[model samples]
Target: MHICHVNLASGFSGGERQTLTLIKQQLAMGYQLTVVANPKSPFADEIRALEQCQLVLCKHYTRSHQRSITADCDVVHVHEGRAIYWALLQRLIHGVPYIVTRRIDNPLKRKWLSQLAYTRASTLVGLSSEIVRQITLRHPQANVATIPSSPVQYPVSNTDVDAIKAQFANKFLVIQAANMYAHKGFDVTIGAAKELEKHSPQVHICLLGDGKARAELEKQAQGLGNISFMGKQSAMGNWFAAADLLVHPSYSEGLGSVILEAMATGLPAVGTKAGGIPDIINHETNGYLIPSGDQGEITYAQISVNPLIPASTICSK
Candidate 1:
C-alpha cells in the first residue's frame, strides 16, 4: 500500500524518531512510503538518507501543500498534532483515509476544531493505554487504536562509551533524558536529586535534554553538587551505557520511549506511575515506578545504589 507520513515538527524528539522508525519498517515491508515534513527539519534529513523513501518538503501545512503531496497515496499517516488538522482537511477535500499517532498525554482542547480533528480521522492511534483512555473519554465515538512507540538501538561508538565511563567513573550515575518541561516532571527529579544529595552523595543525577525550563530547573537545583544538567544530546547510547540507572519523572506521558531505550541498553529505570510509564516499567522487576508529582522522594529512596545489571540477566535468574 502507498502510505504517506506527515510530520511537521521542526525539531527531533521522540515523536520524530517514532516517525522515522515507522517509515523504515514500512519501507522494509515493501510498502511505498512517502514523508511530508518541514523543509528544514531533522526528520526530513534522515528521511532523505533512505533512497527508497520519497521525501516531500512542506514549508507549512497548507491545504494546497497537503493536496499536492497526498494525491497519489492510499493512506495518510500523521505523526504530529498539527498534521492531524491538515489530514482532516485532506479527508474533506480528497476523500483520503488518514490515521493519526497522538504521542502526548495532554488533554485535547475542548474546541470544535480539536474535537473535529479527533472524531473525523479514519483512525486515531494512542502511543499508550492512558492516551487511548483519555481520547475515548473525550469522544466515545472516536475510533482509537493503541500502538506504542518503538525504541531505536543507537549506534554509539566504543570510544564514546569508554569516554563517558571514564569521566564519571567514581560516581554512581543516574540519567534522566527528557525535555525540561513541567509535565516531564523535571521538578520532581530535581527534588529527588536534592534529597539524594544530602544522603546518597555517591549517587549523581545527570539531566539530559534542554527546554524552556532549563534555567528554572538549574536554579532550583543550585548548591546541589550531585545534580548536573548535560543539555540536549544526540549520543544517548554513551550516556545510557555509562549510567547505572535511568529515572523518568514525567507528570504526563504518552509512552515513555526513553525508558524503553534505556531498558534496551541494559539500564534500569525509575519512572513515575503516570500515563504510559507502567506499560514500559514493571515495578521492581524491570524498574521502579513512583507516584507522580511530589511523591517521588519515597520511591527514589527505595532504589538501591548498587550498579544496575542487564534486565536479561535479572530475567534469566
Candidate 2:
C-alpha cells in the first residue's frame, strides 16, 4: 500500500518530528510511503534522505489548489492544518482515505468551518483524549481517535547529567521547553519566576525553544537575573536530564508530549490543568497541575526527577 503523507508547513517543529517518527515506524513495518512537504521546509531534505521513501514537493497546499492533489495514492496522512485542503480533495475526488493528526488544541477553532473539516475526515487522530472529547462534543458525529505522539526517541538513555547539573550547580532549575506561543503561557511563567527569584535567589528558570513571543518573553524576564533564555537546542535530552523540574504553563495542548518525556526521564513536572495534559500527568504523582493564567510562583521542589535508564541497555537495542 502506498501511503502518501502530507504536511506543507514552512518550518519544522515537534509535531513535524513526531509525524516523521511515525512514518519511519510505518516504513519499518514494510509499507511503501511517500512524503509530500514544502520543498523549502527544513523537513523536506530530511524526508528525502530517508531510504525507500519518495519525496514530493507542493508549492503551498491551499484550498484554492486542492484539486491538484488527486494523484494516485492509497492513503494520505496529513500532519497539521495546512494539509487539510489537499487531504479533503483527495478523499472527495479519488475516494482515497485520509487521516489527519490534529496537533494543536485551539479554543478559537470552535467554528462551523473547523467542525466541517473535522467531521469530513475519514479518520481523525487527536493527540490527547481532551482533544477527542472537544471534537466529539462540538460535532457529535465527528470521527476522532486519540493517539498520543511518540517520544523523541524511544528507550531514552542517561547522558551527561553531572555536566548538565554542573552548568547550573547549586541552583534550582526549572526548564520549560516550548515555542513562544501566547497559549504557551510564558508571561505567567515569567511572573512565577520573578516571584520565585525574589523569595529564593538561587531559583533559576531556563526557557527553551523559539517563536514569535520570544522578544516579549525576554522583556518580561528583564531585571530578573534568575531567568535565562537558552534559545533552541538540538539536543534536549541533556537539558531534560539536567533539570530539577519541568514546568508547562500552556493554556491548551493536544497532548503535552514533552510532559511524558519529562516523566520518562523521571523529572517531576508542574503544568496547567488544561487540554490533554491531565491525561499524561497524574497530578502530584508524576507532576503538578496548576491553574491557568495569573497563577503565582508556585514552586514545586524536592520532587523526584525520573531516574535515567542506563545507556548500555538502550544502545544495545
Candidate 3:
C-alpha cells in the first residue's frame, strides 16, 4: 500500500521522531511511502535522506495544494494536530481517506470545527488510553484506536558512561529530559530537588532539553548546588547511562516516551501519576509514581536501586 504521512511541525520533537520511525519501517517492508512536511523543517531533511521514500515540501499544506500532493496515495496518515485540519480539507475536496494520530492528552476544543475534524477522520489513533478516552468523550461517533509510540534505543559505550560517572562523582544522579514547558512541570521538579538537597546533599538533579522557560527555571533553581541545567544534548543515552534514576513530573502527557527510553537503559523512573505514565511504570515494581506537583518530599531512599532490564530486553518487548 502507498501511504502519505503529513506533519507540518517546524521543530523536531517526539512526534517528529515517531513519524521518521514509521516511514523507515514501512519502506523496509516494501511499501510505497511519501512524507509531506515543511520545506525548512528538520523532518523534511531526514525524509529527504531516505533512499526509498518520496518527500513533498508544503510550507503550509494549504487546501488548494493538498490534492496534488496526496491524490495518488492509498492512505493519508496525519502525524500532528495541525495536519488534521489539512486532512479534513483533502477528504472534502478530493474524497481521500485519512487517519489521525493524537499525541497529546490535552482536551479537544468543543467548537464545531474541531468536532468536524474528529468526526470526519477515517480513524483516530491515540498514543495512550487516556487520550483515546478524551477523544471518544468529545466525539462519541468518532472512530478511534490506541497505538503507543515506539521505544527509543541508542548505544552508549562503557567508556562514555564511566566518563560521565567520574564527572559527577560522589553524587546520586537524577535526570529529567523534557522541554521547559509549564505543562511539563519543571517547577515541581525544582521544588522537589530543593527539598531533597536539605537532607541528601549527595543527590544531584540534571535538567535536560531547552525551552522558553529555561531562564525562569534556572532562576528558580538558583543557589541550589544540587541542581544543574545541561540544555539540549543530542546524545541522550550517555546521560541515561550516567544517571541512577529518572524523574518526570509532567502535569500532562499523552505517553511518556522518555520514560520508556529510560527503562530501555535499565534506569528506574519516578514520574507523576499523570496521563499514560502509570501504563509504562508499575509502581513499586519498576519505578515510583508520585502525584503531580505534590509538596511531599522525595528522597533517594524512595527511588528503586534495582535495574529493570537491559536495553535489548526492554526494546524487544
Candidate 4:
C-alpha cells in the first residue's frame, strides 16, 4: 500500500522523530512512502536519505495543500497540527481518506476551521489519552483512536558517548531533552539546578534542544554553575547513553517522548506528573514522576534516582 506522510513543522522534535520512526518501519515492510514536509524542515533530510521514498516539498500553511500530495497515496497521515489543513484540502479536492495524529494535549480550538478539520478526518489518533480526551471533549462525534507513540532504539556510537562523558566528567549529569519552549519548564529545571547547587553540588542539569525561547532561557541560566544548555543536538542516542539521568519537568506535555528515548538507552527519567508522562514513568520502577513545575520536587527526584533501575529499562514496555 502507498502511504503519504505529512509533517509541516519548521523544526524537528519528538513528533518529527516519531514520524521518521513510523516511516522507517513501513519501508522495511515494503510499503511505498511519500513524505510531505516543509522546504526548510530538518525532517526532510532524513526522508531523503531513505531509499524508495518520495520527498515532496511544500511551504508552511496553505501552500502545503497540493494535488500531487494525495493524488496517488492510499491514505494520508498527518503528523502535526498545521499539516491538518493540507490533509483536509487534499480530501476535499481529491476525495482521499486522511488520518490526523494529534501530538499535543493543548485543547482544540472551537473555531470552524479546526472543528472542520477534526470532524473531516477519517481517524484522529492521539499520542496519549489526554490528547484524545481534548478532541473528544470538543468534537464529540469525531472518530478518535488511542494510539500511543512508541520509542525507537537509537544506534549508539561508543565514541560519541565517550565524548559527552569526558566533557561532563565526575558530574552527575541529568539531561532534559526537548524544544526550548516556555511551557517546557526550562525555567523550572534551571530553578531546580540552582536549588541543588547548595546541597547536591555533584548534580548538574543539562538542558538540551533549541528554539526561539533559547536566548531568554539562557539568560535565566546565567551565572548558574550547576546548569548548562546544550543547543539542538542530532545524536540523541549518544547523549542518552552517556547521561546518568533524564528529567522532563514540563508544565504541560502530551506523552513525553524524550523519556521513552532515554529509557531506550537504559537511562531512567524524572518526569513531571503531567500529560502522558504517567503512561511512561512507573514511579520507583523505571523512573520517578514529581509534580510539574515543583522545583523542590524536581530536585528531590534527581537526587533520589535509584541506583538499580538502570539494569532494566522501559524500552521493552
Question: What are the lDDT scores of the predictions, listed in order?
Answer: 0.81, 0.75, 0.81, 0.84
Count of backbone clashes for each model? 0, 3, 0, 0
Instruction: Name model 1 segments beyond 4 Å from true.
Output: 66-68, 295-317
* TM-score ranking from best candidate downward: 1, 4, 3, 2
| Candidate number achieving the greatest lDDT relative to the actual structure | 4
Model 1: per-residue Cα lDDT over 1-317, one tens digit each? 89989988888888888888888888899999878888778989999999898888876767345466777899999975678877888888888888988887878779898788777888888889998888888888888899988888787788988887787778788888998888898888778777666656767788998999999998999898888889999989888888888888888888899999999989888888899999998887888877888634533432453444223322211
Candidate 2 has its poorest 10 consecutive residues by lDDT at: 308-317
**Candidate 3 C-alpha lDDT tens digits along 1-317:** 99989998888889988888888888889999878888778989999899677787777756335566777889889975678777888888888898989988888888787778788889999998998888888878887889988887767878988998998898888888998898898898788777666755667888998999999999999999988998987788899899988889889898999999899889888888889888888888988888888735344322224233223322210
lDDT of 2 by residue, 140-209 (tens): 6767788998777534245566776777888878888998899998888888776666555666789988
Top TM-score hit = 1
Candidate 4 or 2, higher TM-score: 4
Locate the minimum summed-lDDT window of 10 residues in model 3.
Answer: 308-317
Report the lDDT of model 4 for residue 161. Answer: 90
lDDT computed for candidate 1: 0.81
lDDT of 4 by residue, 190-230 (tens): 88878778767777778888888999988988898988888
Q: What is the C-alpha RMSD of each candidate to the true structure, in Å?
A: 4.2, 7.0, 5.5, 4.6
Assess candidate 4 and give its lDDT.
0.84
What is the alpha-carbon lDDT of model 2 when measured against the actual structure?
0.75
Q: What is the alpha-carbon lDDT of model 3 when measured against the actual structure?
A: 0.81
